[model samples]
Target: MEKLNVNPNRMELAELKSKLAVAKQGHELLKGKQDELVHRFVDMVRESKDLRARLTEQFSDLYQQFALVGAELSPDFLEEAFLSSGNSANITGSEASIMGVRVPQFDFLLPKDEISYPYSFSYTNSELDASLRKCHRMMQDIIHLAELEKSCELLANEIEKIRRRVNALEFMTIPQLQESIRYIQMRLDENERGNLVRLIKVKNKIKK
Candidate 1:
């Protein structure tokens, strides 16, 4: 705790008291912000966990389905089918504010033209086609899940920063200010008592 080097006078004491009040108020405001950040971070963490689990399960199934289809089809033919079958999405990116942090938001623009599967029927079976379509549809979910994970990463960083600030004010700044105030008051009281004793001695000498 660093003590301010200043004369222990009434004027300096008043100034220090005012500074202390301002520090306390700022500390309260920071604490409130920290609480809100923590709340948002907790929600994001849960969402991220759920999304990751879903993606893992769905992707595993997709891989297995593709593998089964591969056993029946030639490698060259399967590669050609996959290369031709991928669908394109219309994605628009935007920014959204959560608390004070800005996170990314995406909108998928629906195409006016009818959506069709990319693979030819001659080369692909029904289950193969179905898996391909399912994977295409999940593109949006995959993008959204990516967005959520990135948001969580950003929120985690901000949370750490706010935590440090709150800790500094709570454990260090407020206490130091209070201690300085107490020390000044103690010195002022001692000075007043010394003055009083000297005045009394001078009066006694004058009377004699």
Candidate 2:
């Protein structure tokens, strides 16, 4: 309940009143914004949790598939086979605005449209082929996971910022303004009473 340092005059009182009005309005707007941001943050957190679970399952499966394929082939041959495929995952991403937070949008460039395997069927074993297909499938989920992770990060940061601002207005700024207004009113009233007392004394003297 800290009051601002201010004079006890009508001009200062009017100025304080105006400030209090604006402060209250700003506090209301910030409270609304804080609620909205919290809602968004909670929603994103749930999404991220789901994505993480799915990604964990997928990655575990993918790793097991890779390990099985690795045991079936020599290291040199495995490297050669992977190199012969010449297929790569190209990623592109952009910024998407969600509640003023810039989240990421991701897409993958897979060779599957023109040629999925991009490798010779004669030399590669069935294990290699199967593992490669699984890898390709996993890349899509990996990209989606990336998008979710980034969105979660941005939302969390934005939520923190909004929360801080809301706290400042609700607890500090508005209270200080109201306190200053009350102090100014008390001072003005006291001054008015002193003037009235002076006028009464003058009247009494004139009568005497």
Candidate 3:
């Protein structure tokens, strides 16, 4: 640890002590922030994992359903039906703050009449109708999963940044400040002893 360049005097010692106190206080604050950020990050990661798993399962089932429906209908007819369907949504994006980190939020607004199949129901079987309905209903969950994954990414980045800052304060700044304070105190004490000895010698000479 390197000592700061300052005069060996009471004024310098006092200043160093004050600086050390501030440094320690800042270190504690940063450590606290790092811990809290880590906790939240872990929780978000778990949540994202679970959500991803559920979505994956649901998507697998939805894919099989679509495949079955495809087998029953002609490719051109299925394509035409999907193209004519009037399923649409408006997605709105916004921001949310978690422990000073801003993450994204998304919401989808459905039309007043809700999603409707404009395709000819007479030509489509029950399987096709069911698959289309499920696909449209899954849109909200897909958006929610996207939001969670994005938030997790953003939170992870923020936690890494805080960890670096906390490590710097704990391992470098605080230790350096403490070392400088100690060096100044020792110098001041030695100087005080020298001055006292000099005064005693002058008194003895006058007495003689």
Minimal lDDT window, size 10, model 3: 111-120
- In terms of TM-score, which candidate is stronger, 1 or 2? 1
Instruction: Pick the TM-score winner.
Output: 3
lDDT (C-alpha) at residue 71 in model 2: 83
Expressed as tens digits, the lDDT of each residue in 1-208 for candidate 2 is: 9788888788998987888788788878867776887787788778878878987887788788778877876788777655655576688878888767778899898755543565567766776677666676677777787888778788778778878887888889888888888898998899999999999999999999
> How much is 182 displaced in model 2, in angstroms?
0.6
TM-score of 1: 0.89
Which residue segments of model 1 deviate by more than 4 Å? 112-115, 206-208
Cα error, residue 199 of model 1, in Å, equals 2.6
Name the lDDT value of residue 110 in candidate 2.
Answer: 70
lDDT of 1 at 125: 86
How much is 152 displaced in model 1, in angstroms?
Answer: 1.3
Per-prediction TM-score: 0.89, 0.87, 0.93
lDDT of 3 by residue, 88-138 (tens): 679999999887889999987887555578687799888887877787778
* lDDT of the structure predicted as candidate 1: 0.81
Candidate 1 C-alpha lDDT tens digits along 12-44? 889888988998898888788878888888888
Candidate 2 residue 178 C-alpha distance from true site, Å: 1.0
The lDDT for every candidate, in the order shown, is 0.81, 0.79, 0.83
